[model samples]
Target: MSQLQDNFGRRFHYLRMSVTDVCNFKCTYCLPDGYRPDGKPKFLDLNEIEHLVSAFSQVGTQKIRITGGEPSLRKDFTDIIRIVKDNDKINTIATTTNGYRLAKHAQEWYDAGLRRINISVDSLDPKMFYQITGENKFDDVMRGVDAALEAGFERVKINAVLLKGLNDKDLPRFLHWIKNTPIDLRFIELMETGLGHDYFKAHHLAGNDIKLQLEQAGWQFDTPAVDDGPAQNFSHQDYQGRIGLIMPYAKNFCASCNRLRVSAKGKLHLCLFTENGVDLRDLLQTPDQQAELIERLHGQLAQKKETHFLHDGITGVTQHLASIGG
Candidate 1:
């Protein structure tokens, strides 16, 4: 298989496919009361999706992460997994879920060749969790975590999106939960992903501050943890699990950016913050143009944004995270 390398020499090996733009929970950070889907009802059908993945795999993409507004909301979610599972080149099939619908489908998804799972849990406090997510489903997510572990899936990591005063007060609470399990806990810096720039700026907590706070609380910062993505990992002498910080704002990880995202609407997002990309859906719709489509994809990727402009003025694909497939 040919490796899809950009002009910057970064080889593309991972693909983030947003299967559906519909979600159940309306998280304030991602989806809110007024948020709406940007794509058609059936954006990318099963065959179109499989063909795109096949084209990408030929260009050295070994891992595919299925994302969404909430992927489980789609009835064909499991079918998409099964379709990708048949590919010998793609070694991993992962999904980032809110965990509301996971308890019921964890076992089924696991059986359908799902490998990795990252569940989003901001706070342990019921009211605080609801406030952040605008959904009173904390217990359901907890049950989903338990269900993932029980399904014989190991390394079930927890993703906590860190905010200034919203979820920062519960940092110790999150650390305590990490101490109780062997699963990894990751703290993601608030990204200015077109949700509400002002809100993001107000709650943008530097990764260094979070690390310092943990150190002051007696958590020792150890060596980094191993992972596929860009999260900086750490460990504590007293804790069994590991801690990770994804600082896309203060510290940009674009130098090593090797992944590309395809929104549910079928547009290729070369960079999370860049508006440049190709309309793969339209090209694929044309008959007998697979080779043309592949060449066009490479052309778009050759222009992957140098950086997301985290510390600078943010001007790019400023769409909400729900539509962008976080």
Candidate 2:
């Protein structure tokens, strides 16, 4: 099988597939006003997802991360997990969610073959979480985290976007919470998008600040797994959990690029901040189109840029992170 290699010699092995663009939460950084549908969205159905995953698997894709505005909102989410899990070529099946429905579906998802889970928990403080996510489901979300662990997931991670003067100071609180929790807490840098320029300017905090503090506290860097996301992970000898920092602004951050994204509508995004994506929906309509779909995927990689233009203040067509499952 031919690996998905770009002109820059980056071989892709991970696929982030968005099952839907609809999110129920109104996060201040992402969907501040909430998700507004655009004339009845026509998201990819089960058949298309099966064909899409099959074509990708043929190209040496080893991991598929099911993402969404909140992937758990989809009624067929478990079936989606089963679809990716059923692919013999796929070795890892994971999903990122907002944790709204995790408590209710954690066991069902794990039983369906999901092994890894990532939940968005922007704040440890309940009020602050509500302020950041614009939802009062903090307790519910926390319960879901525990449920994920109890459900026997291989790994469980929590994602928190570092916002200035907001959850930035909650590092100590998070550290204490993770001491015995055995969870991987990841702090993501606030990325500027087409619609969040002012918000980004006001709230963006450097993930390096947290990294520096972690290093000072004796947290040692940990080697990443073969298909791990861009997070620089660190572990402490005394703690059960780990911390990961995702600093997209850091130099050479894209040098290790090995992941590709597919939007709910079947557009293939070579980079998170690309100007636009190539539509694969036409080729995803039938299993017979798998060969052409794989070929188109390879053709698109040839045009993948060396790096995203986020540092240059060019966000491309991404109005917000939720639109394409950031």
Candidate 3:
């Protein structure tokens, strides 16, 4: 099999595929106001997604992470999971959701072969959660998490974007909750986007600061898996759960790049902060297009830059994280 390798010798093994660009949560960082329709969104359909994933699987892709504004919002979400699960070449199938429908649909989703789930839970405090996400369904989200565990997901991950004055101080609360619960709590540093420039400057917290605190508390770094996300995981002997820190700003961060992202509309993003994405929708139309699709994907690697220039304040064309399933 021809592996997806860039000019820098970085081989891609994971694919982050977005199903839609619509989200319900009005998070202060992402969609502060709310998810406004950006000129009649035309996302990928079931047949398109199947062809795309199959082509990727043929190119040595091992894992597929389905993301979106909120992937579960799709009516055929379970069917989407089944689509990826049907691809025997793909060994790992995961999804990142807002937990809006997990309480009721987690079991159904798990039954469809979704083994790993990453749910966004910015704050453990109900009031702070509402303050950050502009929603009041904190309790319901927590119940959804409980439901996920009951539905047989061994480890559920919670994603929290570390914001300076908002939920930054809530680390202690999160630590306590994860002590007994088998959840991998990940704290991500906010990235500067076209729309969140002012907000990023005011609330962005360094992920390393949280790393320092975790290390001081005796949490040790765990060895990363071959197809793991960029998170640097840490584990404690006494706790049932673990902690992960996603530091996109850290030095040589892109040196270990192993995943590629494709937007809901079939545009391949070389990097999250790239100025433009390569259109792949045309090649994803039919099953017979698999060979051309794989060749197109392989040829795009030459356009992949060594690293993103985010530190230089160049956020590319990304106005909102929700737009590209960040």
The numbered model that scores best in lDDT is 2
Instruction: Tell me the TM-score of each prediction against the true structure.
Output: 0.92, 0.99, 0.99
Q: What CA root-mean-square deviation does each model show from the true structure?
A: 2.4, 0.7, 0.8
Q: Write the per-residue lDDT of candidate 2 for residues 158-186, one digit (tens) a residue.
A: 99999998998899999999999999999
Q: Give the distance in Å from residue 292's predicted Cα in candidate 2 to where it truly belongs.
A: 0.8
- lDDT score, candidate 2: 0.93
Clashes of each: 0, 0, 0
Give the residue spans of candidate 1 off by over 4 A.
38-40, 214-227, 285-288
List candidate 2 segments past 4 Å from native: none
Ranking by lDDT: 2, 3, 1
| lDDT measured at residue 185 in model 2 versus the true structure, 0 to 100 | 95
lDDT of each: 0.81, 0.93, 0.92
Per-residue alpha-carbon lDDT of candidate 1 for residues 73-133, written as tens digits (9 for 90 to 100):
8889999999899989898889999998989999999999998889999888999899988
Ten residues in a row with the worst lDDT in model 3?
147-156
